[model samples]
Target: MPLLSADQLTIQRGDRALLRDFDLRLAAGELLHLRGANGIGKTSLLETLAGLRRPAAGQCRLADEAAGLHWLGHRNGLNLQLSAIDNLRFWCGINGASPAGIDAALAGVELPARARRRACRSLSAGQKRRSALARLLLQPRPVWLLDEPLDGLDAGGLALFAALTQAHLAQGGAVLMTSHQTLPAPLAARELIL
Candidate 1:
């Protein structure tokens, strides 16, 4: 069965229909990229899929329970006063996951040992984004909903992100993300233009 399915989904903002009769299905180990110009509701669609907002019409069905999905939005979603490891630990608690992988997950994001102990507000934009991404490694989920995940990432960070995404796919995880750039080689991503 598909991991996620959206049938005849409609999204609107203030009576301005951003999407209508939109349909999508994502199976395990699949990657789907949402593309369009600015203000085209890419974020809206992702938010709807994440259950952050209600769609104007239609419905989204998830094969697994809602908690089995992960949503990474444009914001880093970190507390400025919290250390990188602490931030991930907090998220792990919320997800009912173990905190044992906190160190390894931070390392996966290329955050230095010293940096991991520093507050999130002290990190650079890319570093902050990486910290947020560490949550993915800390808590393995079947489906990922990412909005502009590549933003603020450096070339090295981008490579790391791609590698992580590929690893997730290899583990039978599905991803639905919005990105203007094409993914790196061998990811086998399908594209949909809004």
Candidate 2:
């Protein structure tokens, strides 16, 4: 079964209707890559699917009973004043996820111990991006909604994201993402143009 589906979806911003009558699905072990020009509602589509925004015309559905989902927006959703560890801990407390994976997730993103201890505002762009990506690992959601997920990554960060996403797919999870960069060589993705 498909992990997520959208039918007759319409997205708008203020007076502009950016997309209309769009339909898409993301199945388990698959990735749907959203593509469009700037200001073309890619992020809006993702937000609607992630339940952060309301679609103008249609609805989004999840086949899973648990509503398992992770949303990574274009912004690195981290607390600038908080340390990486602290931000992750906050996410854990809110999501009822165990803190055990915090360290491992940080390591998986190649965030050094020193970087983890510093406030997010002090970290480099790549580090901040990795910190946000770590949230995916901190919680085991079955579906991921990612917007501009590759914005600030270095080669290593990109590699880590590809590996982690592939692992998620292998485990029967699904992804819906927007990226301007090409995905890593081994990860296959279906393109959805706006």
Candidate 3:
């Protein structure tokens, strides 16, 4: 069965139909990329899939429990006052996941041990982005909904994210993300243009 399915989904903003009768299905171990020009409802579609906003018409369904979905928006969702480790701990607690892998997750995102101790407010843009990406490692979910996940990432960060995404798919997880750039080699992804 598909992990997620949107049937004849319609979304509108102030009578302007961003998307009409759109449909999508994502199965386990699959990656779907949302591609389109700006103001074409890519973000809105992702937000609806993430359940952040209700669709104007139709509905999105998840085959599994809601807890299996992880939504990562354009914002990193990190607390600037907290250190990277602390941020991971807080998120893990909220997700009902253990914080024991905090250090390993930080390393996975290419965040050094020293930087992990520094407050998020002091980290650079790329570092902050990596810190946010570390949450994926700390809390493993079956479905990931990411919007502009590569926005602040550098070359190396992009590679790391690709590797993480590939590993997630290999583990039978699914990913739905929006990105302008093409995905890196070895990660087969389907494109959905809005």
Candidate 4:
């Protein structure tokens, strides 16, 4: 069975159809990239796959079912009032993941020294984005549903993110992401334009 699968998926928002007859499968270590024009429901699709939103039709099956997935939305899911470390802790707690290796996770995103610093209210846009990504490292999940993760990242940050993705895949994790920016090297991702 696929690590994650959505079969004949359909979703609607009020009178509008967001997705129709959509299907997807992610095997272990595979990465699927989703692309579409603005307002085409790419974010909505990811949300449904992550179980944050319900689909009007179709079935979603999590092969491991017990090991949950992580959903990173366009909003970055950061708290402006909390420190970067605190933010990581909060997401870990929510996901039932312990804070072990949290510092290393922050370091992986190049935020080691500033891990204890206040959040995005004082951080530059790129820093805020990196802090948000740090959650992926600290949290333990088998699948990732990332929406526009590369949005505000600089060239250097993008390079770091590419490496991070490679590492995640190497660990046999599955990823589904939507990005306007082409993913950096070592991803070997397949595209599905909504």
Whole-model lDDT values for every prediction? 0.90, 0.90, 0.89, 0.85
lDDT string, candidate 4, 106-151, tens digits: 7889964854576567887788888888888776678998988898
Per-model TM against the reference: 0.94, 0.96, 0.94, 0.94
Off by over 4 Å in 1: none
Over 57-114, each residue of candidate 3 has an lDDT whose tens digit, in order, gives 9989999875578888888899999999998889988888888898888888999778
User: Model 3 residue 5 lDDT?
Assistant: 92
Query: What shift in Å separates residue 39 of candidate 1 from its native position after superposition?
Result: 0.7
Which pairs clash inside model 3? none
* Superposition TM-score, candidate 3 onto the true structure: 0.94
lDDT of 1: 0.90
Off by over 4 Å in 4: none
Residue 181, model 3: lDDT of 83
Error of 2 at 162 (Å): 1.1
Q: What's the lDDT of the predicted structure labeled candidate 3?
A: 0.89
Cα deviation of 165, candidate 2, in Å: 1.0
Q: C-alpha displacement of 173 in model 4, angstroms? A: 1.1
